[model samples]
Target: MPKPANDNTRFLVADVANLEAEIDALLGAFPDLQEDETLRADMLEGETSLQAVLTRLLGHEREAASMVTAIKKRADELDARKKRQERRQAAMRALMLRLMKAANLPKVPLTEATVSITKGRDSVEVLDEAALPARFLKVMKSPDKTLIGEALRAGKKVKGAAIKTGDDTLTVRAA
Candidate 1:
């Protein structure tokens, strides 16, 4: 949902893909180098012009192998996290449907909910239900109005607008 989350997934996949491509390129190039080396060694064992270059390339190949190993491990971790997020999104969708049924409203997917509250000049960003310290902020309310009534009963100075849901009232407060 957040930009960082999306970017991270894309980056992990790209990293793995790039590493695979590099490995394939190295293996493809190795065979030709192998034949050249055998010919040169037979013709002139002690003096091969390509020996230094070959040594450097082999060192690079070893370094690339280490990098690829690390990338593979990181890719596995990202894959697991991606799967977990998919599961969470599914569960949240189901919960939203149940809430809609209870409220007797047409089912709708939950979009990003924004609420404003007191904040210091240096305050960094907005808050959300997913990142709240508590699941929901309990607010007293009457049947007259649900959302605004809950906000009025919160007993805190309303700095600005707030969003209310069946389970949570997200009111931003500055640190």
Candidate 2:
């Protein structure tokens, strides 16, 4: 039987924890095993085991990243398909509306549903926005992060904002 997707990850995590504990125990018992050859062999074996577990974990990480990429591509394809369907539906609705208007049928009764064309709500159409009075327009303002960062870097202090360094990120390379 095939294992679940997360089984390998769980097993690798458990292995790493166990290997760490074993290494710690070996270090604590070093004083008691003074000059014993088995202690050196055990430590070497533990180090090897830890390396293997870490390699497996890296492999799993790569697999997870690949899955995410594949899912994103599929999502894009699905979105494109949805948009095409929406356009087709809109065109069909427009055609039906035009035909109904030509036939002077404001409402059509069908077995499953009723189709009707009613007056839409009133809306304002602006031909020249700049010519509008101040009260009829809205003013929006926002802080520019790029400018803020530039000023901060130039040794200027900004109120309610300060330069903050983020934590280091890990990068993995495939061999």
Candidate 3:
């Protein structure tokens, strides 16, 4: 199974855990500033220190986010390159199969590689679905949602379908 791009990362850097602990201690030492806004003006020095700590934490978060974006971009580039390589490989495999078939050989053993061509299952090509034999077709029960939506959109009375607008959502982002 393929793992997701956003897997957990273990970035070995400065001891952020210790800094977080110190920040927690500072907050614990003066819980009044957060709970009581009036205490903010009174404890000007403590407020300044808290602001600095918060700023540092925010900066660290921004740095980590930027790094994540960079990693995702790099991963996507590598994935695209890998797919291109796989396509080239498939192309070579196709060439090899054609060579083997043209030479009327089931298998050709080269010095560096071996080529083999074998028969695959008979694939069905549906030229006209209506003209297909009963054995080639399978009947199934399903709803035609498109037709139902069209009927509802035209204000026609559909027994099992109704037209309702979707809800609106507000998106928040950097200006």
Candidate 4:
């Protein structure tokens, strides 16, 4: 018979706890069985529940380890591909910038689009905020909390910058 939709979704918490406790007790009694010789002796000499559970757990552990290794290898491959793509993009941008500098005309018209060598607005890099001109230190970004954050760290009360709580996330691993 087919099970209900939520049947698989439901957790057997108590059952898992009972199994864990039983496994722990069994492990405590047969600590020496962790060695290959002792374990092989127990496994070969008896057809028991402990043997079955241990075998199942070991198989699951191996499978989990293999899966984890495969996933990490895949992720590393993806990261390498991303880095290659980023390098290509950067090289293309550099070539475009070189072409713009070489052109005599600022506005170069093409069939589909226009490329302009327009200069971007100059951004001020504050070396010393205390020594900076008050007029120049005016708000460029609305709700800017950078100054306040610095001031707060320097033992001053700043309205915008307060230490906020960090976020929490789950970390999964094999048991």
TM-score against truth, every candidate: 0.37, 0.76, 0.50, 0.42
- Candidate 4 clashing pairs? none
Please, what are the lDDT tens digits per residue for candidate 1 over residues 60-152? Answer: 456667899999999999999999999999898677666666777663444665322222377556466567566455668645456556777
Q: CA lDDT, every prediction?
A: 0.57, 0.82, 0.69, 0.66
lDDT for residue 140 in candidate 2, whole number 0-100: 98
Residue 43's C-alpha lDDT in candidate 3? Answer: 67
Number of clashing residue pairs, candidate 1:
0
Residue-wise lDDT of candidate 2 within 24-113, one digit each (tens)?
776676765546768666665665475677677787778889999999999999999999999999999999899999999999998988
Q: Give me the overall lDDT of model 4.
A: 0.66
Candidate 3 lands at a TM-score of 0.50
Q: Estimate candidate 4's RMSD in Å.
A: 12.0
Encode model 4's per-residue lDDT on 1-175: one tens digit a residue. Answer: 2232243212233334555676566657777665677674565347335555545545555766799999999999999999999999999867877887887667778898887776889997778899977887676656556776677778897764685668785354556
Candidate order, TM-score descending: 2, 3, 4, 1
User: Which of candidates 1 and 2 is the stronger one according to TM-score?
Assistant: 2
Descending-lDDT candidate ranking: 2, 3, 4, 1
lDDT of 3 by residue, 1-175 (tens): 2222332312212234444565576568878767776665456445335455545546656677899999999999999999999999999889887877888999878898776777898997778999888998788989898989988888899886777789886453444
Which is the better candidate, 2 or 4, if ranked by TM-score?
2
True-structure lDDT of candidate 1: 0.57
